[model samples]
Target: MTDQTPLRSGGRAARRAARAKALPDHMRPIRPGMEGGTYKPLTEAGVEAIHRAALTALEEIGLADAPETGVAYLTEAGAVQGDDGRIRFPSALVEDALARANRAVTLFARDPAHDLELSGTRVHYGTAGAAVHLVDVEDNSYRECGVQDLHDAARITDTLDNIHFLQRPMVCRDIPDNREMDLNSIYACCAGTMKHVGVSFTDPDFVANGLELLHMIAGGEDKWRERPFVSNSNCFVVPPMKFATESCRVMEECIKGGMPVLLLSAGMAGATAPSTVAGAIVQAVAECLAGLVYVDAVKPGHPTIFGTWPFGLDLRSGAMTGGSGEQALLTAGCAQMHHFYGLPGGAAGGIADAKMPDMQAGWEQMCSNVMAGLAGLNMVYEAAGMHASLLGFCHESLILGDDLIGQALRCVRGIEVNDETLALDQMREVCLGGPGHYLGTEQTLSRMETDHVYPRLGNRSSPKEWDELGKPELVRNATAKKEEILAQRSRARFDAETDRAIRARFNIHLPA
Candidate 1:
């Protein structure tokens, strides 16, 4: 027995070393575009009812304040402008627009390997927000977020396995000019990661300049059109049923430029929208349906995401509650609506109302993230690092969110009950004549990497082992990981000649 002990220990060490090595993309337990429709918050009848309500609202209530170009587009596409200047869509017009909308959309990345395929129940999680402040966990304070912070956040996101894409997560307060800020936002996000980027234009005028930058990055206008990597997250609608004029113009420009558009409708319950969850969903769906018609009018079958992001509001204080259970249900139900329409969709999730990455942040982030993934949201935006109900972004929280999302994705993967996964033979071997345990079995060793997702920073050690290892706190470990990732040279940055040309052409704010 003593002689065999050394061999057993060596074998265990070998297994540990094998597990430490990274698995190829195909062998990884969780990945982008995993199908997840396990937990449906809305019944089929409920989805149908919401769809009918949205159609009714568009037909009767209508939406007002469309830009001149948008009015022409919608009117040409069979919508009528009422005496009140509101565009009223007949049910047939809405049906025709839905029929012409692109059902399968692919959000391209600078690197083709990272492109996201959006269809069916496939899910993808990523970062997004217009956070004005950055949460400093060590200082326990908040400060205005700048372009440098945005770049660093993108760099960190590039290294995370679970964060499938990086949307512009913060505003560049350092750049005083909105035009410069818009351009800088594009550069910072594009430079920081190879994943598909999502950005918004503050003005329609800036979009031409933004496209020129993208053209240079993509080699030329023809190439950019062939594989447009960045999408315009256009908030075309202001609220209950009014078009944001400037944003609608921006959407038109984006669509004309061959760039994809996220037709975003962000209404707050009890504020911009109705207080009830179903009512809020109805309004958001109606607004996005209108935006969809506008997009199809500009160009038939244009790549567009049905972005129905209706946020939750704490009625008592009139504050946004992005982390509440109600918010989770709202996002899930919206995802169902997207599936019903057979359109690719996106919505908010994984937000933390807590100011810091603490126990409260953990629960809040996990609850929404898990629900969002289970609902099979095509694109889960603001899925990490958002805090204070989208007011702040935190680096440590973002790092920890990678682990949280990995686990959530595992839940989305759910269980496989086929012959191999059931493992009746293995169970029989263990319970009958074998070692009476499954540990150290051949099946266990073979399935370790394929069947389980091991968190990079999540601690699962025994108490004694943890104490011996210095009892590392979660945020401290996350901070260390953040430092390590940023300390490395950015692989996602453009080459020297391209970078130089970009800098020369634009007022690039990021440091060399």
Candidate 2:
């Protein structure tokens, strides 16, 4: 394929080229209920139902009646104070929010040169890994993962067409300094990658340094400014009570700048609230509404993304087992809560408690991701190759997760009905025959693009062929894919002068 290559052929081909240029391609869904399967989008009635429930929770059931500085602010903002750590919000207050919030927003990824369009039923996935695990050739001993690991993983993830975005700072544990110098972790994690992340909710100094890192990587402040650094308004509950000051300040920053923030607050039923999904969903809503008051206080109608970083404690071991059906249910219900507010929501899905890749890992990862997509979440982070939630990263887990993401995306293709697939005449042309002569037909070949998810992880080989090649399992194959990506990853393209500037900011001298 030389630069001056001649490729087009046939009169029909010429006609196609002309038609394509004159009129861009139109879209048709993949035919709803094609095989007794259907997806339902939220209707006006459904939204109203969720709102009514939320109103009842706030007006009646109430929130944890506790005293916190953040809750004190909410109490000032028309939230009814109650006893035993319970507070209720007026339903009118919530209805007013639905009329004012932005439901869609674009997240700046990489240098804003890489951002994702998040709206509608679209969902994105990625990971934030600390303590490198699976890519290792040794024991639990993590590799010296620093800037190199960040760039390495970023490059691999960027090349994966299946991965929607790379969550910033994937390798924080191996970066030497975790406490004071930690935001350096965010700087390095986001340096050359094309992904979205707020500076990992760092302190002011680290945040400043991380911003400096972004300007250097992106060429200038203007370039960095071109892509808004995403931030979070993480609301913390003082046991069913209110948010923290740190959370409040973050929300102020996000709302003031019109930066997207994920306001997540979790209450455990029985442990934190009642042992009911509806009960918990309402509590989560009230928690986020507290965040909304902060956002509205800073700048009315700020771009806010709803989130749920909830987990239930296993009272026996007192472990936060987030990888459970309870969490999945929370995610689905959380999606509804945000939608009710007419805001983009973020949820943690495709998460697992598995220490390594196994059946448990696959099941947990796939179910969570699919559930989030079905709920039409905007950002679904905590992605693949991550083991035991945040224990470390794994090449195998990443690979399998990538495939799982592809599967979830395929599910969202909805339905397509056109001349190519409707095949009314084609069906009539072949149905009566012993064999449907559709194989290798022109329509069959042309439409396979919209038809399948080409798997790079799971086994698709016959027993004989697999046995001849040493019978590798799915995990083994996934590990090999990660290695392949690593070997083939080349340094990102940057002009020498710009490159020098980037290196110089980091105090590294480059050749003239």
Candidate 3:
């Protein structure tokens, strides 16, 4: 446990070795662009191509106004009506919108007031997926999501400080307990124990509950006013780019209310989008911009976070997969778009296509997260535990996300070109022919505390020592971490009377 070294000396076999010191798993498994996996992403040049294509989509691809007044503003901006009466964006108009946007802006959540600071640390972690989790992929088949799972997940996130927010897991049955009630239960549990929340988006009733929770923590409406409660306002766009009504409604609610909302529009290329990947990004961008326009239209400069998760159609299964290269490309490109506008960009992470935890899960989570990091995105929405596009939450997956976020955060800390880091004096000293052993230097000792990454499960010992210590997979390692967190004392607490009152209101009972 010395400050100079993160790993133990005698390996796991050492009598004093307590494996409690390793970094979380998500930070460990990362390789760029699937160079080491089956998945492949669009090249940097490809991203440039898509950027050009996005501009063209405004001009050539053009947006067709689907009769939504809120969406029609883009048409007024620069899009023309085609023979089909669709409002098509001209290249100049698309460029204008990009130019007009603010590159980086903080999103304020009004009710459960919070500020999403999205600079320096480019990515923020949060829950992923929506709808019901019919299949319990981890335990096999579908099972009802009970109170235990929700509470446990919230606890796990609360204990793990790296998780940015605790989002409700989509359960099979929200019970009579309507969807709103089910959501409230999850939110209540999360707000009760956790300090930060990504906040469940959609459903007006749930939104109200979220606002109440935010107000309670923030103390009053004035505090919420200064800092807004943030949530996502998603749009389901029809192909070639068209906005849905629900998206517009949510955007206005969060905006006028002064809460930060991420405008997300996911369209499949060759399906909900145009045939090409570039075409899809253009359409998706238009869809997101249309939502932003709503925010600006109602109250100009309303705190908004821009984002998209569009991907190329697999053409095999009609599912929206988050692990696609096009998805990565779109995530990165959208960051550019948001930056172009000087607005914070919302990206995604911890996405896995595997029905259960496996190599597929690990790989998808790694690449998707990296794309957001490399692009210098402001925040990532689907930042964790995304299996089947967020259908299920694997406990291990969430654990992995904490580490994944840590890695993404580390990446955005561009190389510091300071005197110490540049090592100029050391290089000069070495050139003088005197033995310059940096290993024992005070500078090295001080830097090692923050510079090097220590793993939670990565065995640093020689193979023989590792074999002697009994090789363990990452899951077993994570299981231990979970147990450790649960066992440790957490200072998080609420008043007993208030806890009891909250339980009575929600019809939930917590053991004393």
Best by lDDT: 1
lDDT of each: 0.93, 0.59, 0.57
Give residue 460's lDDT in candidate 1 (0 to 100). Answer: 98
Error of 1 at 321 (Å): 0.7
Task: Name the lDDT value of residue 99 in candidate 2.
Answer: 66
Clashes of 2: 17
Candidate 2 local lDDT, 1-512, one digit each (tens): 46434443454475456534422212211211111112333456765675676567666755553336546666666667666565666777656656676666777765444566655555667765344444463343444445556656666776665566666435454445543234545444444355566444533234455456556666677876666654543554443645455545545544444446666675665577555665666666666665665565456666676665554445676554556777676676666556556577776677677677778877877876677667766677675766566555665566677777777767766556778568887777677762578874556644544466567667788999989978887766766776787787344445567656656655421123
Candidate 1 deviant stretches above 4 angstroms: 2-10
Tens digits of per-residue lDDT for model 1, 1-512:
99999999999999889888888888889999999988888899999999999999999999999989889999988999999999999999999999988889999999898999999889999999899999998889999999999999999999888999998989999999999999999999999998999999999999999999999999999999999999999999999799999999999999889999999999999999999999999999999999988988999989999999999999999999999999999999999899999999999999999999988888989998999899999999999999999999999999999999999999999998999888999999999989999988989998999899888889999999999999989888989999999999888898899999999989999988
TM-score of 1: 0.98
Off by over 4 Å in 2: 1-91, 110-114, 129-151, 169-171, 174-180, 229-239, 254-259, 266-274, 312-317, 417-420, 432-437, 488-512
After the best TM-score superposition of candidate 2, give how far the Cα of residue 397 lies from its true spot, in angstroms: 1.0
